[model samples]
Target: MARIGYARCSSEDQSLDVQIARLTEEECQPIRSEKMSGASRDGRTELAAILDFIREGDELVCLRADRLGRDTRDVLNIVHELDQRGAYLTVLDPHITTRGEAGRIVLTTLAMVAEMERRFIKERQKEGIAQAKAKGIYKGGTRRVDREKVLAMHRTGKGPAAIAKALGCSRMQVYRILDACEGAQTAA
Candidate 1:
């Protein structure tokens, strides 16, 4: 049975070095890493690949339970999936594993803590934003896409997919921009 590792960070700016180093120290092979939010399972292709590739009797390792997922349901679902495949999960930070009944209990408690931590983080962020706005210092999120360029390309018969590809943004962003432009035109 192989021992595989998975590492993740929420955004592109965050570093996966620490997790990778720890996993490597544990002699985990074929480590999978990704830059995506752990709040949900969506858009985590590396995680998906790991789930699909892990075989029976293999151990799936991560630096921490939160690295696997922050939502309790998502984390439980992932563990259930691995269980169904006869694979086990090992969280290194607190050294919890599914190999024992006590580990399962600790893992469940940690999952709930992680979920609560995520909610607390969001609440803190919202409060900070509100305070900043009240102080006239909140400018909100920066726009990565050029609105005029998107509109120009759309007027020239470019589709949302093509525009998104060229602009280095998601198709959903392209659609929102185009839809907003159409709404503005209708209002005019």
Candidate 2:
């Protein structure tokens, strides 16, 4: 059996050191971490990799239940996957493990709490945005990618991949900009 760790931080500005240290203290080797939101399973490539890497008799350790996931369905799916693979999950914060019945129950409860907390966070964020909008202070997220530049590159015979590489963006973004430009032209 192997002990593997997974650490996460919601945003790039956040640090994963604390969670990594805890997992290290637990003697968890080959730890994987990522900077991504746990609000959903989307874009969490490292977590997905860990899920695929774990084998039977392996242990997946994390610092907290929320570190695993903020959605109840996602958490349950992860646990079920581990169970089916004969692997166990160890959460250090509350010291819960899936190796026993009691631990399983506690883990489920903790996951539910985490999901609830996520919902509360979203609600609070929406309220904050609404308040800011009411005060004419909420402008929304800044657009980092220059859609006009992307379209210009495409119009100059640059392919989506080339435009994306030059602009430090994804090909999908380039395609979207080009598509939008085309749609605008057609509408005109």
Candidate 3:
């Protein structure tokens, strides 16, 4: 009868440390399953570890519903799965626990909205790319510091570190520009 908690984060800078701390305060053992993205596949190792330890009537805690899963189908599926396993989910910030009807409905609605928004963004991007291609225009522009600027600084006898400083980047960028400069001469 272990009350296990699962903590997830979208990126490195967004920490699950605080969520873990809260879970610890609640006397629950926290499993941290983090990723660089939310768009990946269905499962996470930390979540699996939490599931492995949960028993009937055991509670699963998270900071927010969004931290658990991203879309309607995914969230509902996960919630349903946990319920079938006799485990309850509690999201701290919104104070929603799937043990009640209102919480389930709220979670479902939020998931649906997020999924719909994601679909709309994908559709819009596709349309934009299609329009640009139809007009014989490139779909993307040069990098923030593309070839011309890199070459211009290098031709001025700027060293890698100095060039990186001038361009507000790093020494690696300077080396890349130098390599590109060498390749440019070969191409000519």
Number of backbone clashes in candidate 1: 0
Among these predicted structures, which one has the highest lDDT?
A: 1
What lDDT would each prediction earn against the true structure? 0.90, 0.87, 0.72
> Where does candidate 3 stray beyond 4 Å?
40-43, 116-188
Off by over 4 Å in 2: 143-188
Worst 10 residues of 3 by lDDT: 34-43
TM-scores for candidates 1 onward, in order: 0.79, 0.78, 0.58
lDDT of 3 by residue, 32-118 (tens): 555424443343555666666677888888777767776777788778878988988888877888999999998888777767766
lDDT of 2 by residue, 1-188 (tens): 89999998886458889999888888999999887678888767778888898999999999999999998889889999999899989999889999999998998899899999989998999999999999999999777579888877877998987987798655555676778888999999
Model 1 lDDT per residue over 42-80, tens place? 867789999998999999999999999999999989889
Q: What is the lDDT of residue 32 in candidate 2?
A: 95
Worst 10 residues of 2 by lDDT: 168-177
Which pairs clash (backbone N, Cα, C closer than 3 Å) in model 2? none
In model 1, the Cα lDDT at residue 111 comes to: 93
